[model samples]
Target: MGKPKGRKVARHGGNPNAWREPKASSPSLSSVTTAEGLLEKLQSYMESCEFVVAEKFANRALERFPANSRVLEAAAECFTETGNITKARTCYLKAISVSPLKGWRKYLGLAQLLEGQNAVLQYTRGIEVMERELAEVAGPAQVETPNVPSASSSTEKDTAEIPTARDISNAYLSISELYTTDLCDDDNAEEMCKYALDKAMMADPKNPEAFQQMANFFLIKGDKEAAAQYVKGGLTLWYTDHLPPEQRISPENQQKVGVDYEEGSGMPGLALQIDTAKALIECAEYDLANRLFTEFITHSPTDPELWYLNGFSYFLHGNDYYPQARSALTKAKKFATTPHGICYDIIAQCDEHLESIAKVLPPTEDSDNEEEVVQTEDSVNRPEQSNCEDSDWETDEEGCEDVEM
Candidate 1:
């Protein structure tokens, strides 16, 4: 009984509103068997490019293990990726409520979901979480490392995997950017920027963001020299791949920076800048390292550490950019956001380099008629007659490795 072939019927009028088939309902959480099974299935499905199936399992898993922090955390990441901001926020909240110390990740994700002052509060909360977690990790004022057999690989692994304050800085940097970018139209944003920058340094002194922001702090305050030095370590950079002669660590090159960044090579991240500088310095390529530091300072323009590293690189860079180093180190002293300690040591070293340079050089034209200058200043590692190897500068660098360049 088929309808007439070319029925001139008004389809819309015939059926004013079409009836739709009912959607299939998700499985009951109670019957999902176990959280482990759900998690495994979720992972397996995800790996097999079955995201719809994976999401279904994740939804069920959340229902069954509502208080499982891992499940909540995973949900937060998944929700975020899928643009489910509301669900992501809810999941992050549950995860954080259950484990505040481990909520830095969630805080960052949650911050992105909020706008204006609310986002700032979330970011602050994240910083606080990191502060508390770092304190907890440093529980014993000092850890007594007993001689353990190499066979105890598990113990070694435990030691290796333990989170440290430095480990938290990258997160702090990300949160701080929300303020700098003014995504939420922050009030007293500069202060907020500094707040996170301070914490970022406390978490990891060598953090590029912290260094860059600190430079910005100075720039915003109208101190261009300090700002420039903050990022560039106050040295005038010289581009070259070859190392200058060791004898060049004199007043003539005291303000010089040397580097060779590849053209069109995009700027490096904070960690990459630091690592590359460290490697260059270790290999006696002070000029190349100085160039890298300059790039960071040029790009970041707010990191106080870049200023310090700039100065440090100059000290060992064999360029004798001690004047710029002194200028940079002096400016760095203004911002004591952390107990990095190197600030003072570097200042002392700068004084030494300057004094040594003055003592060795023959009387200059300007000072020929002046009284013999009294050798009042203290000296650090003095240069050898004719040459001082940059290797000598590597001695005080060990402890700072954990902090920054």
Candidate 2:
């Protein structure tokens, strides 16, 4: 079949003269060269940083070649370098608009100038265009290594370096400090705390700080049991650490552990330790909380909040530290009195949680079940059935046994 009129043919299947050539151009290379010479002089003036001289030359060139790209670009550059960004940007846009091929470079230059002035939105849009042009380049992209580390790798290294219960604890506590001290947004503050907690757990599984942070997060979220478990875990670690700073006490022993206290940042890391202890207490990790509070007290001997938290932490332990709790409350009382004092308010509210332990405590007479029954003797009780409700209360059943609270 014959090809249709004006139909194209595949290269190898058709006559080679199918494509036509235009007649030789009237505007010869010499004429363009003549115009380029004028532009070069303008460019030289612009490069010399003499805006007046550059503008003069560009105006003269434009009179002869009103649409000359080089003249426009030179004038724009002069204005741009000499602090006339508004005018420079307008000229650049015009030059690029005059030629589709120059669009990307023009936009890139404009973006750079805008960025210098902090015009983020415009600069970012220009950057997008520039990147698109880069992607279109017909070659393998160069692999450029940044002088500074990549953010991802840098963060990973930072996370890796914070290994150890103390380090993890300090890290989380500092996050809290930033929230409380730097007045960061509450949501962001919480996020920062959570991030540190995740890192702390990865750094040291047994780090009390990690557990305590979880407890605090949950407590804030109102999950009491989960919070309690975390608090317990943290305090447990704190207790273990307290077993003996002796292993870590001797300089020789410290050297063996690879810890160089002498090479420290001189500013007492005491504040961090104190804050960690406070977190422990906040999550109701009482026993270890007391230990840490005591240690801090022994060291500083005058931190008012330490005294209050110490006494309150003991109070939270119920009978375990009834005497100590009273003592702490007394000391804390000296420094505070509002019904909502951090120590007193917490101590009082803790009474509700403490009531649970109080119920099952002090095995009642004739207690038969391995699981002790703790009936809420107070109004705070949830009104749930006690094991004492067995038929044995009135008659023999399941080996009736009575217990006293």
Candidate number of the best lDDT: 1
Report how far residue 196 has shifted in candidate 2, in Å.
7.1
lDDT of 1 by residue, 122-175 (tens): 777876766655565778355443343332224223432344565477556666
Question: Could you give me the TM-score of model 1 versus the true structure?
Answer: 0.44
Each candidate structure's TM-score, on Cα atoms with residue i matched to residue i, is: 0.44, 0.32
How does model 1 fare in lDDT? Answer: 0.55
Instruction: Give the lDDT of residue 106 in candidate 1.
Output: 72
Residues 351-385, model 2: lDDT tens digits: 44334434644433422121122222122332234
